[model samples]
Target: MYTGNLSNLILNSDSYKTSHWAQYPSGSEYLSSYIEARKGDYDVVFFGLQAFIKEYLSTPITHQDIDEAEMVIQAHGLTFNRAGWERLVDKHGGYLPLRIEAVPEGSIVPVSNVVCQVINTDPEFYWLPSYIETALLRAIWYPSTVASVSHYCKGIIRQALEKSADSSDSLTFRLHDFGARGASSQESVALGSLAHLVNFAGTDSMTALVAASRWYRMDKDMPAFSIPAAEHSTMTAWGRDGETAAFANMLTQFGGAGKSVSVVSDSYDLWNAIDNIWGGCLKDEVQNMGGTLVIRPDSGEPAKVVREALERLAVKFGTTINSKGYKVLPDYVRIIQGDGISPNTLGSIIDVVLKAGFSADNITFGMGGGLLQQVNRDTMSWAMKASAICIDGVWKDIYKDPVTSRSKRSKKGRLALINQTQGQPKTIKLDDLSTTDNLLRDVYVDGKLLIDDSLTTIRERAGW
Candidate 1:
């Protein structure tokens, strides 16, 4: 009945996992903590560990389940230790005896080292479950990567918006998540979408929308939003000859005052559709309908095509200078460049738009693979390692100082993330920090979600 990925279970044996289990010191679990931090590229890492609460910690595997797993792996001609896993689970009544303390959801945590910590909170259970490390950590890397990438995209757009838009409040909705279809799986879509929603409110991925709500305890008032739009199939289905009819139908459906609709214009000649069909035939109708028409160019050299398209649109609907001295497109017309968009390239495209005398507010971005799926733990160099271990009621600092890569060296002792705008490396010993001032709070402890963050609270912290 469970016919999904067995990779994490079967293939993980090859991660030299026996060594991982053996590395921990004997009598190591009076109270030990490991920090999960993005150790490279990013200085401040946004926390998006909500998915693990539902998928891993809440779904406990019994001793019988471990025995069944051993049989399942042996079916593939590989050896597994059912007895080892069952013995570990027996100490805690088939539940993981761990506590996860994290910077509140959406908190901008300094990654000069440690952000979230996974520790054995219960003294009755000695030795942290080795397999659970991989289980919980695998869930964070993807969502955290997406959230980090998406958060910086907001920074890029925010800077551009401050220079061009009259009001900078629309930065959150400027980049829409179009990544659900391109994600590796539906579960991948859910994780990536919820991560994106931490900073922005726009999405085209209904899979993401539904998944986030289901897993994160989100209500019907979902954190993400979307607009009516057509894909290549929907547009090309009408045929080139019936292009005008297709355009007319979209107008009839979505072209009302303040309404936003995206119509793909490159199914045929991109220019002819914009000039003849949309501008030539429907210009007055668009003006009279009093709605925003989002012209989507799915394929072409991004900077050149967007600049050329915007120039022609300015010629058709006309433009006015904003207070920031950039040309602002008419209220009813805009451009959306959905292809070839990454964090850097997207900002550059808007930079080109600003050079071409158009405000950044006139264009928004919809990202697919780039926004959600096409990154890894290395994208931000995420790692979770044992930093402190307690033996015989003594909390001793523990770390790995590899001579080859000093950056791989782990921090020692518990962590408390501090928000500092100075933009330098932030490091403080846990003993030096007061409990009230520490940003990392108890999130999960012994099969209970201690602190559940509301979507609004998360949004506000993310600079809503």
Candidate 2:
């Protein structure tokens, strides 16, 4: 069995030792959320917290843990509240000291709004999440940002399809996840790719598939699918002289399966592979096989390379313009740009290729960092702040309003997300919170899991 280094396990902030004062009465009940999509006005997808709570909240604080934790604090030249912590442990019987209510994972909540509420159920444990905030924010930040980006990209593809393709049937597969190697960690691959899979069905990251199946209770039929394809290593293993053999080999293997095959063509010469090999040599095989020949360009300017490749493929294999005024490539051939694909670049690439007369159906996107890791909490200006504090058997509205920047000011008062039956959702005070119909559900309480949603259910709720 693998054991961790003690220093890494035992180290923590001195502020966490006594930081409850850093919060209003020390991290009291607070309703916080992705109140603003500083990245843009895009709605935020509330997700990943269920997974976080499931993994981390399976057990609660034990007196032994508190005693050991207290020793670490005192060793760091900090005050350790042995009695205070023991009281909390004794009262809660070692469960998490907090309660969390969130909009169902995958519910598209307004970015400038509340998605969850964090409260200390036991007064003695108010200081607990003062340290836990980092992980909590992280749980919300990663998946929410990733889901937002993917959702926006999906909207772009949907628009491009409506305007450029014969049908929008390929919307789900237009943007594929090729970010596993680009993600920061195994957990990142799971959270980021699961978020993206909320919007798209094509993913090259198998690690994400396992995560969705295990955590979200999903099957292969739901989100994420991949096709048989060749990478540079697979081609180069055949040697450049054997490059023709590589192409022939790929076609020979998957061509007869009546499914699409993607070939990485830019290893030695992109145009040569597209013309001499894919278009020239395998043209008959591709046409007669009843499956697509996906030409993937891995280098060069995304817009320029994709546009130019489409032009070459059209000249060699031919094309037909769709009713939408954009030309459609022959059904047997298409271009998917996996290199340097992001929301911004993905759009420009599609536009340039479309202007060159290729339908959006003739193109797809595969993104790495931009789709998975290229974001921060500030990307959406997400924050979890105490809006209200319970003291003296009364709730008091509290917030920060720095005159230096109004944008940094936090929301005030106990909050309720009033998701209307026929109107846009609004945030109101708890006193005015009359509707039990509010979308927020108690997702985690103390040490118990209150909700568990499937990937299919999430996708349906997210309007996929």
Candidate 3:
């Protein structure tokens, strides 16, 4: 929906980038910049670049956009490159003359390797790559960070299930997305939630569905699904006196054969809802239901509360031991911990359940702000730096080696990511390897998208 001036690519950069058009060396004819995450606890899930290229770079710049950018930049005390933009519009049909090569979307790349390389196809626009760094880096880092976090959580859950569960049948639904409302904007909701969906099939974020359909070519087969669930307002609206009635309503509406429903049960006293009401009053109603009832506790120390809730629920509903010797509740009951979940806490909660002799299948997770808003560009120390530049048809290697922080040092020369049969992928200079040896694919060139990845394709590459 962002149209007119807001959608103008010329205005998407930082105001200082306007001045950068003149800051480059006088004979600078081409500049090469590459993006990489210099440090992190684990490998990254490289994503979102395809979506950005399709959404932003595919649109041709118009004369009106140049005019609007000129007025805004001048009024804001920055010089605008009107003639440069005009020439781009006139000669290149309004498309940027840039070639973007990147690792395949959803590739689980290790830290400190080049994931994307950007260089101008037309030497006249040497500054284009660095000028668009603001938008380009933002596009790569945010969703890629979210995806990495979600991917890490998936590994935690999978390990727990392997250690304690009889089967990993519910692995894909182990972590649910509850981060939509906690996101900073709808775009964040869409991109962040979609990144989570790459590793899981459960979500309550609908914006991610629309985005997947639009950007990742998921229209025919949607990548995520959600069940009918209740929040605090719905439970409390019936009054404390009518608490049992609200529980009954959810069971009546969504509880049936081959169906499930989630109800937030911590509005008042979480223990009372589990012990007095669900255990005493509606115990029979729950057991006789044809489908599973997921009880969500939204306020507590996550690990302690989940362990206690699992113990209390087993006492009332009874539990059967799986082949792995871990206790699992009957098909009619389950627990979901939606409070205080983040990458840091996720592994501990799963570990706690496993240590308590409970099957990982007996529980799922719902993460909100922790999943979407908790990360930033610095989560993995992501940076886009000029590694090489061309002047008058001669190329020279360039990079920064900050003595203050060795981790901030960057790579030099034109980089290429190549696969190694034995270990991690290697980042080498392009001159050392033939073009065919590089794993970096030309995904975008002169306004044309060469690789259109689908959600299914991304899921496969991410090891889903």
Candidate 4:
């Protein structure tokens, strides 16, 4: 009854687009006639037949392919259905719907937390198990990954800010979700990046624009406002003569409306480039035009380059160029370091840069690839198992062999999750069947999803 735009979206998205349909036995029909008769009551089995059929229908598979695939899937579906149907019908006449309680999207949850739960309403609905596995796993895993990474990046930004006295004056840089396009699959790139961008404030205007238009119903031009706000930001090139010149020309064109620009200085001889080419007239021109200059170090020890640059600037402009009282010279030009900047590397870089008498506030980071693609397996692990079953008019929790690698173990009977804040955070799993205190709530019920979140909303909630 809470139907609205979400329901319409789901239905429209799920509906068959082509003028084609597949015929299959109804779930009830299969259960009563074939399943119950063949398999005895009170058995546990996975239900995936309908889901397989639905998946096949959604594709551009030819009729012949569908028939072949359906033959194989239906056999498995019917086999499980027979076992599961007899158990549910003869024992605990299915009454309860499956209940699932999961962490809200964008929340950073630790390992061993009950990130999700799946339960059945009627004992008979136990047969619906296999049908929901992939969806349930994906619903939790992808968002959790994005949330965890976003949390890490937030910490990095916080640390960088904390090391400086004038942190308030430091640029609040955007966290671009550049990984989505190059690293992930096409569909995932579109949706996953949107989901990531919800938490990571991306500098990639195009991704932000697309996410805004599709998910937020806003125009693509919204993020353009960020360009001018970060107008004096530096640009980087390969540090080669040709690369630097090309990049400078492009920046000149891009900053045509009197925008300030920064150039990469380490292409040939960084000292020569800065002291001779960039340090002389170009620096004067940019400053005279009321624009700040920035120099980026792409290769060779960043600390050394930043130290030299800082020393040069301090000697050249003893009073420093204070743009709006923010101290643009001495520490005038910003130093941006790009390659291999992980948490440890960043900490080391900051220590060195600070030691070299450069204000930590005068530096910016352009991190890509490394931060986004790196995954520490120890931080997260995934597992799926059969949690419950109806046996002889009773629902029993299923447990697995503790020592076995594939031990699909779960707590017994109707499980309730109790969230108790005692010192360190903890979750107590209760086995009492009578207690419904912390039963999992439904995120998607009766094939109707309960939540439809946008990337922007996700990003805001994630606080990245």
Candidate 5:
């Protein structure tokens, strides 16, 4: 009897799901459902399903889990399907008799297209597909929404870099993940940060690194990188008078040839730190550091502060015009706007910096709550709905047409995601398309993980 109090898959769902096994049609033997970003601002970056599978679904549910779940369900005044759960444990060894097909991890699928499809493999477990919807939908939405937001930010940065810089070489590091501390949990940060890493290669989230290594097979080559950087505590510990000393220590410790380090420079005052401290007293040291000293401004409106800071830094440290006619910060100096950044403001900040005649390369962003914790499931309008069902071995189309909200109208029949060759993928009837043409691949089948994707492969699928 496995008694470890870790998560039990049987109980990892909404309480209402406990009674769903008895509510399905009398002769129902299988249920087919699909998940998609119904309609949203950005295409879904299909990702993190592999992590969900490895973490939750791959493990066999023990008889101990069934017993414990039944006890809890009954106590909650919900009907527990003891017979169904016991049957699953005995017949399938607690492995879900379901097949999960999804777009390859990191594939950017347009909104309203199927990102994942679920169907129970065993005829006896008709409710299994919908029963797992709570976990399955959650596993897809949060990470995919974060990835979509990150991808949107990347697009904004790409446009800025192309217009203001000589090359887009610095694009990957233009946005850094400072989201670990702001996330709700270590698991949340791990998944959220990994989503950001799909488009960018910088992060301070250690859990994301472990997640990528463990689930995405990034051990041999780590996917994300972060430089030694200072925070408020580190800078403020020196007192306002000792702020310059603290900044100097950071450069001395982490600065070297062809290296990078970040230091928060707005402890007492942003203007004084840039003008007197960094530009006046420490100008020589900064210029001679043989690397980049990324100065971070934590307060004030991001766009306005970055524009002002760039002007002051240009006056003191000097800047050269790039090939794109934008002022490029010297090799040793840069800026990072870490506060108050979101999808709306990130582009605005970059636009301000670029419009000030500074190259996009002169500034990077460190996002905290805006990157990880700000979004919810509806940010992408994600939902999983039952689309088809098999009753007494007869398949039929099914859907929910909610008159209250036309956007909530669910897809119908067994679905297949097929690339249109010119535009985004289209969700069509599975019977209408050949299996080879379907973008949705069988990633998980009856407890077996079929596609073990690496972070590199996923990145490539997301356009790197």
Candidate 6:
């Protein structure tokens, strides 16, 4: 379960108090009410705090046990009381609104493309910077990482498919996202990786189904597989016994339901089991019963296992049995490869499988950690420097950097982000608002969010 302790830390931090320490105008009263109503929900408070503490604090605090005495004193100092917080909220006008020109959620964006931007909801509440920084950064980083990797995998899959002779079979490719339960963070594991898969246009509907049910208000029983004519689907079952009754029972169950069964065939002696159970017995049963059988090799060298399985199928089921298309008996029994498949390994396996007279279409890939844990180490550093502060009806750029480095300098004057989609890329300085043809549009105005794009919409926009 995801404990929202990070949210709590942000709410109860002195930095938050310092940032959103002002009052707002009449139009932005909703922001004020929101902060007031949820002031005492310490769980939410702790959730916000977790992010802040992780970023700012030198030492770690146990999420299981927080020091209450220290918390009370810190909360008091941070102005957590009703009156003080209301005063702060009123001063800042209840919320800070950010106008961002992000590279949409799923797009394969390189480093230095402004992924997002944040600003005050009310111009007067510009002081609320530190309070929002943690959440904003955390939200963008991991999802972007997953999306980038997924985009790379798409290229790899396309390349593999291009080298195949049977182009018709490429359309039925499956890419599964098996990283959710093992991702670095629980939020990223569940939500961020789902965003990645959705963006990549993958066939793993289970990830999307779970995300929709949990995060968005969608029906849980929504089907994962669909087609215009027939509803084709895949079902997985595992067992250790080579020719035991358990394997027979499962085969019967799968065959009875009019669904193709993919059995894990390498539990005992992989070669022996395939010959005795799958090739000798189950093959005839499934063929006579009008069912398809798929053998899954979950261990050892994928190429070797696939070659051995194919040879066994040929000898036992007869060399004349067609393994392609939907008509023949052995055609129903295919090999699905899993376990420790990296990009390089997958490439090598494809080479070997095709060389042995087995078409690339004969195998299925179930990839996991190699794609998920892979990182593009390129660093894209982001810093929000104070651009301008108003004083006595005059605005001036506020620039300050304690350590001066050539690359770390901030652009001065009243700045506006000019995005020229048609022309050459350049940053132009504007002294007056009317000077530029296009300026950064307000995404969130007066604490009311204007850009409300759904996850699916964002995923499509990613185009991985």
**Overall lDDT per candidate, in order of appearance:** 0.74, 0.77, 0.91, 0.43, 0.90, 0.46
> Cα-based RMSD of the predictions, in order?
3.0, 3.0, 1.8, 11.2, 1.7, 10.3
lDDT of 2 by residue, 292-384 (tens): 889889999889988889888888888887888887788888888899987888788878876777788889888899999888788888877
Q: Where does candidate 5 have its weakest 10-residue lDDT segment? A: 1-10
Check candidate 5 and list the clashing pairs.
Answer: none
| Model 5 accuracy (lDDT, Cα) | 0.90
Off by over 4 Å in 5: 1-6, 434-436
Q: For model 3, what is the alpha-carbon lDDT of residue 381? A: 94
Q: In candidate 3, what are the lDDT values of residues 242-268, reduced to their tens digit?
A: 999999999998888888999999999
- lDDT tens per residue, model 6, 1-464: 33334434334344444425454223321111001010110101001111222233312223322333235546556533344334334554433333333333343333333334444444444444435554554544444555555555555555555555335344324445555545565555554455445434333335545554554333224423421111111212233432445567667666643456666656556687678877766667856656556677678878788777777776677533133421122556666676676666777887776676665556666566655554322222434444455444455565555475655555554454355666432333446446555333334443444444444455455442
Q: What TM-score, over all chains together, does every model reach?
A: 0.90, 0.91, 0.97, 0.64, 0.97, 0.64
Name the candidate that leads on lDDT: 3
* Candidate 6 lDDT: 0.46
Indicate whether candidate 5 or candidate 6 has the larger lDDT.
5
Model 1, 1-464: lDDT tens digits are 75544533323334444334445567666544555554644444454566677655665557656755665666766556555566557766666677888777776655555667777766544445344556566676778778878888888899999988898888888999988788988878878887888888899878766766666666447777778898888877888898888887888998897798889999988898888877889888778877888999989899899999998888888899999999988888888889989887887898899888889988999888998877877777777777677776778887789999998877887666654557433556678776436667788887887876666677777667
What TM-score does candidate 2 get on C-alpha atoms?
0.91
Rank candidates, lDDT, best first. 3, 5, 2, 1, 6, 4
lDDT of 6 at 250: 60
Writing each residue's lDDT as its tens digit, candidate 5 over 15-69 gives 9998888898899988999999988888889888999999999899999888888
What's the CA RMSD of model 3 in angstroms? 1.8
Q: Which segments of candidate 1 are over 4 A away from where they belong? A: 1-23, 39-45, 72-91, 122-125, 419-425, 434-436
